[model samples]
Structures are given as C-alpha cells and as structure tokens.
Target chain A: MTHLVVVGASLAGLRAVEAVRRDGFDGEVTLVGAEEHLPYDRPPLSKEYLAAEECPDPRYREEETFAGDLDVALLLGTPASALDTAGRTIAVGDRTLSWDGLVIATGAHARTLPGTEHLEGVHTVRTLDDAVALRAALRGGARRLTVVGAGFIGSEVGAVGRKLGLEVTILEALETPLARAVGERMGRALTHLHRRHGTEVRTGVAVEEVLSSDGRVTGVRLGDGTEVDTDVLVVGIGASPATDWLDGSGLTIDDGVVADETLAAADGVYVAGDVARWPNALFSDVAGGTMRLEHWTSAADQGGRAARHAVDPAAAKPYETVPYFWSDWYDGRVQFVGIAPEGADEQIEVVAGDDAQGGPFTAIYRAGDRIVGALAVDMPAEVMKYRRLIGGRKTWADALELAEQRRVQRAQKQAAKERGEGA
Target chain B: MRINVDWDRCTGMGMCESLAPDVFEVDDDGSLILHTEEISADQEGEVREAVAACPTEALSLDGPIDA
Candidate 1:
C-alpha cells in the first residue's frame, strides 16, 4: 500500500485524509500534528466557543471516527521537526517516517507582540486550548479587555466581549478595521458596526507594551505615552504560516508553502490549507503571484482537493475557487465574494434594500462595465445569486436582474409558506 | 437530495438560497437556514446550480448527484 504521510493534523490535514479515502485510495495514511489534541474547528474558538455555547459537540472529530471510518494513523502531539524532501522522509522528533506521498498542511500560528508572552491576562486565540483559556478569563468578568489589532479575530472577540458585558477597547494600527482586505468604504462601515455595538475602537493607535505586575496583566501602554488600565489583553495582530520546519525541505516557502495551480509542490509532495499559498485564478493578477488564505472553510476545501490530486495527479485540476469571506460583528453579518480590486473604479449600483438600519443590501463592485465583486450585508440570498452571476461571468444587467428576480421569488415563496403551500 | 451547509464554511453570501428558493433560506442574522432536508426532483437542477454557484464552496449536495 502507498503510504501517505500528512503533516499537521489540523482541519485541513484531517479532511485530506477523508478525501484520500473518499477518492478510493486504500493506502496507509499517517496524520501528524504538533498539538496533542485531535483536529478541532478553530473559527468557533473565537466566536461561539468563547461565548460558551456548548462548544459544539465533536468539535472536529473523535479519534475513533478517524481510526474506524478513515483508517488514518493519528500521531498526536508529535511535531514534524524537519523534512528531508530528497530522501522522501519527515523527521518527527526521534523517528523518521517515509512516505509514498506527503502533504504539508501545517497551518499558521498566531502572531503576538514581544514581551507580552509572560503577561497573565494577555491571550491569543488559535487552538481549542486558547479558546478555553480565554473563555476562563472572560468568565471572571474582567474589568476591561484591551484587544490589539482590530482584525477579524480581534473584532470578533471584541464583539463577544461587548456581548459579555465587558468593557472592551480595540487598538488598531490601521485607520480602519479591515482596510487591507476591503477598502476604506467597507472598512468604515465595519468601524461603524463596532462603534454602534459599544466597542471603544481606537484607530491608528499602537500598543507599546503590555504592562504587568507580578506576572499578571495590569494594563497596556500606548505609543503616545498613555496607559489604559485593563484586566485582559487580547492580541490579534495576524498569523504567520508554520513553515519553519521546511527550512531545508527544498520546497518553496514564501509567505507559505508555494505550490503550483494544482496545489502540488514537488514529486510526491503537496500543500494545502492556510499553510499553502497557491495561485488562485480570482486574485492571481491582483495579489502579484499567489494568494494565501487563513480561512477555516477554504482550508478544508483545499485539503480535500489536495488529497484527491495527490492520490491521482492525472485527475486533478487547478485550484480556482471564488474567494469568499465573512465577519459577524454584533448583529450584523458582513459577507464578501470575489476580489474587489483596490480603487476598483466602480460605482455602487443596485442597493437592494434600505442601508440605514444595516439591513440586507448588495453593493455591486464594477470595474468600468464589468461586475468584479459583490459585497452583501444581511443579504445571503442575493449574495448567493450574485456569486453565480460573478462565476458565470454574467453581464452586469443580467446579474442585477437575477438579484431582483431572486428577491421577488423569495418574498413569494415566504408568502406561500405562510399560507400553508409548503410548511 | 439535500444541501448540507457547513456553517463554518458559509460566509453567508447567501448564494444557495437565491438560486434555489425552494431549498434554502436565510436566518435573521443572514446565516443560511435550510428549508427542506430533501429537494424535490423538480428543484434538483436549480439546487445543483446553486451548489456550484457557491463561491465559498459551502453548499454541497447531501447524497449522490451529477456534479
């Protein structure tokens, strides 16, 4: 049997094993992970799990499921110390494991500020344990929570903090919350959402140091020589791909493990998940060469795709899925599909509903006459419709008409359901 | 037969509900709420289109179907 050695037993790694099995590959599959725990979902760690919402049973999967259903050899708590690509073996601590095929789904690590590690109240949410620890700190009803970096994780945690009735203040070095991804317009809209939810969102501010006394967090010092007293400090600056183990692995490691369009790195080796920055058809031109995403769901999709390709390279196609992401702040659900270029040079056409209350609205991003991307706020149906329109390369007029038609159809269906046509 | 949406994967872009209204619906917070567990034979084509149209690949058919 061909031995498939998959490093990094994350969501992506676990899913890859399943995909390999589903692809009819009756082979020996070994899944290695640095963390001792079984593969669990990470997105909920910051949102639902922190809110103490049952933590979602079977966070990812039980070990028994992997053993019985997938027939995967789970090597928990063992880190891949190094990769000998030429030799086609991975050095996991004292043992050397050979492989007919290899998959690098190491994923990314939470970036933290220096000197904040020893601080008691300073926390970063990445793994299940991180969420458990943060939840424990939040349950204590900390007087205030200072969040560094107003990115998605920070903002989401801040939203949870406000919901938990904790005094929350977010320090963002950028002028807007998501200025890098969504331009100032959308970023400002998110900023408004944060402010509306009673979060003290401070933009263009930097945290100089996390002040701690007796190994406990006292407060944080701002770059402007001001001190903000807080019991807890959450750092959400960003994440770096965990590719240090591949230093001499001969695999290309840029921001992540660089793979071809098919997600293959070299012979008998593949990359997937957040750790693999592969060429994406959607953002290839805009992102220079390749795009690296840390999305939980995308990683799973990529894992499945990579596994299929690794099992049978002749049957694989290039990884070209539409880019999609979402943010849940307060009661508002902000979802975006496709890449809206910087200074997209487009007008916002077809505002579906009222925007005053932040209800359902679809902002069509156009470059001249072409619809490049769609931003939907509280309008999943329209967003779903537009996703097809965008993927099909539908004309702007057709997309607009489709959006309108779907809206009317939804209303009619709801009316019929209420009248007992369909329960 | 049915569309299973991994909510974690769902960006709430709402593509599935739009293409196949007979199948999918959105909650108050814009998260996808499946209306029916199994799609009628008539709505399969639309549901399949909706699944393919999903940008995030969040929507997938429950059972065997021609993709």
Candidate 2:
C-alpha cells in the first residue's frame, strides 16, 4: 500500500485524505494536525460562530469519520516538527513517520500584533479555540470593541460587533479598507456599508500599542498618540504561511511553499491549501508572481485537487479556477466571483435594482475590449449570466447582449416553472 | 447533476455567469451563487464552456444533468 503522510490537520489536510480515497487510492494515509480538535470550518469563526449564532460543529470529518469512512489514520494534536524530504520521513515530537509520498497542507497562521501577549480582550480569529474565546468575550457585553485591521476578517468582525450591539471602531493603517485586494472603489463601498451599519471605521490610522491594565485590555493607543477606550481589540492584519517546519526541507519557501501549476515542489513532496503559493493565471500582475489564498473553503478545494495530482501524476493539470468568495455582513450578503484587481477599468453593463436600496447589480471589469472580471450584488440571475460570459472570454459587446438575453430567458423559465410547465 | 464549486479554486473570477447566465450568479459580496440546483441538457454546452473557462477549475459538473 502507498503510505501517504499529510501534515496540517486543517480543511485542506482533511480534504486531501478524502480526495486520496475518492481517487481510488487504497493507501495507508496518515493525517497530522496541530490542533487537538477535529477539522471544523473557519469562515464561521468570524461571523456566525463569533456572534454566538451557531456553535462550532464538526464541519469536516472527525477522527471516527476518517477512520470509518475512508479508513485513514489521523494524528490529532501533534504537529509535524520537521520534514526529512530526502529520507521520506516526518518528525512528529520524538517519533518519525515514514511515507512514500508527502502532502504539506499546513495552512497559514494569523499575523498578530506584538505586545498583545497576556492582554485580555486582544484576540485574533484563526482557529476554533480563538473564535470560542472571542465569542466569550463578546458575550460579556464589552463596552467598546476595537479591531486593529480593516481587512476582510477585521471588517467582518466589526460588522458582527455592530450586530451584537457593541461600540465597534476599526483602525486601518491604509487609506482604505482592503486596499491591497479590491482597490479604492470597492473598499469605499464596504466602508459605506460599515458606516451605514453604525460601525466606526477609521482609516489612515495605525495601532501603536494594545493598552492594558493588570493584564486586561482597556483600549488601544493610535500612532497619533490618541487613545481609544475599548474593552475588546481584534487584530486581522494578515497571515504568513506555516513553513517553519520545512526550514531544511530543500523546497523553495517564499511567502508560501513555491509550487508550479501542478502543485509539485520537489521530487516526492507536494504543497497545497493556503500554505502553498502556486501560479495563478487569473491574478498574474501581483508582485509575488503567485497568489496565496488562506480561505477556509478554498483550502479544502485546493487540498483535494493537489491530492489527486499527487496520487496519479498522469492526471495532473494546471490549477485554474474562477476565484469565488462571499461574506455575510449586517443585512446584506456580499459575493465576488472574478478578479476585481486594483484600478482595473470597470464598466457598468447591468444594474438590476436601485443601488441606494441595496439591490442586484453587475459591474464588468474591462481591459480594452476584453472582459477581465465581473462584480455582482443582489442580482443572482444576472450574476450567473455574467459568470458564464467571463468564463467564455466573450467580448464586451457579446457579454452585454448575453446578459440581456439571459435576464429575459430566466424570467421566462421562472414563469414556466411557476406555471408547472418546465418542472 | 451536482454542481461543485471549488471555493478555493475560485479566484472570484466570474466566468460561470457569462456562459450560463440562467444558472450561475455572483452574490453581492463576490461569491458564486447558483440559481438552479440542477442544469438542463440545453445548458450543458454553456456550462462546460464556463467550467473550462474557469482560470482555476473551480467549477465542476458531476454525473448526468438529468440525474
């Protein structure tokens, strides 16, 4: 039997084990995770889980599920300390496990602010335990909550704070929220959303220190020496790939484990999930020359794809998929399914409803005559049509017409279905 | 047919909407929203085109559409 060893018991690691079995691999698979708890979803950590709206359930397979369903061995709570790539062994604590193949799904770690140690109420959301702690803090009815970053996680948490009836103030070092990812316009849109929902979002401000007295966080001091009083401080600056274990593993570790389109690094080693920085055809203009995404669902998807290629090299292909991400904040659900690069020339082809009232709309990102990406809000049917147009690489003129045609066709289909003619 | 969305594989690159506008949509916050649970035979060509056009191979059609 092929002995496969996977490190980092995250969404990616769990899915990799499942993918191996799904791809007809009856091999001896061992999954090693750092966390003691079973693999659960992380996206909910910031939203529903943080708000106490839902408890953390086993989103992915547990030890019993893996052992019974896939017949895979799971090593929980033990992290892989070292990778002996040449020797084909992984050092976990004092014991070394041998493997015919290795999959490194060790996801990234949330970047935290210095001096945040032992400071009560200063938290970062990455793991289930972190979410549980943060949720407990919120349940205590903290007077004011200060989020240190304006990125996705911070913004989502800020939205949650407002929903929970807490005074939420966000401190962003950049001029706008999500400046690095979605440019000024979309960021401004989000800023508007936050402001409208009663969250205090301060841009161009930096967190100099997390203020505390008697090991309990009281507030944060800004770079300008202005102190904002608060009981909770959540930092969501960003993340760094969990590649410290591979210090001498001979694989290139830039921002993440450098892999090609096939997610292959060296001869017997492979990387996937947020820890692996693979070539991205969609966002090729980024400075890193590759994209390292650290989302929950995406990590699982990449893990499965990488596992398939690792099990059978003949089935390997370039990793290409339309990037899709969603966030539920306040009363509205925001979703993006395409590259909305910073400063890309965008054209508004279809606006389904009134923007002021929060309705469906589609904005097409265009570079010359070619449609590079699409942004949709509320208009699910129109967004669906635009998704197809983007994939087909259709021209602007053709895409517009198709969008109109699709609207009409969908209405007809819905009417037909309602009349019991299309069911 | 089960429509599979590899969320990690997706870069929020909206191609699915273009090919089968009747089936796939992007939500307000920029995630793929599926309009139909199952696709029809007539929509298969466009669906395939959308899937193939996915820069990340995030979209997949499993089994038969009628199934």
Model 2: per-residue lDDT, tens digit, A1-423? 388888888778877887788667987888898988777767768887777665747355555788798888878887899988788899998889998878899998889888785688889999888888999998787978989888888888998898899999989999978745655655666677787888888999978877889999998888899999998889889888999989998889999999988788876677888898888764453323777776554576688877777777677888855555666677665656556655653444433444443334555665556565655555443544554455555677887676677567767766877889645
Model 1 DockQ, alpha carbons vs. true complex: 0.30
lDDT of 1: 0.78
- Tens digit of lDDT per residue, candidate 1, span B1-67? 7767877777655656656766786654566778787877898888865775564557777776542
Every candidate's DockQ is 0.30, 0.20
**Cα lDDT computed for each candidate against the true fold:** 0.78, 0.74
Report the C-alpha lDDT of model 2 over B5-39, residue by residue, as the tens digit: 88865645455665576877654345777888676
Candidate 2 is graded, for docking, as incorrect
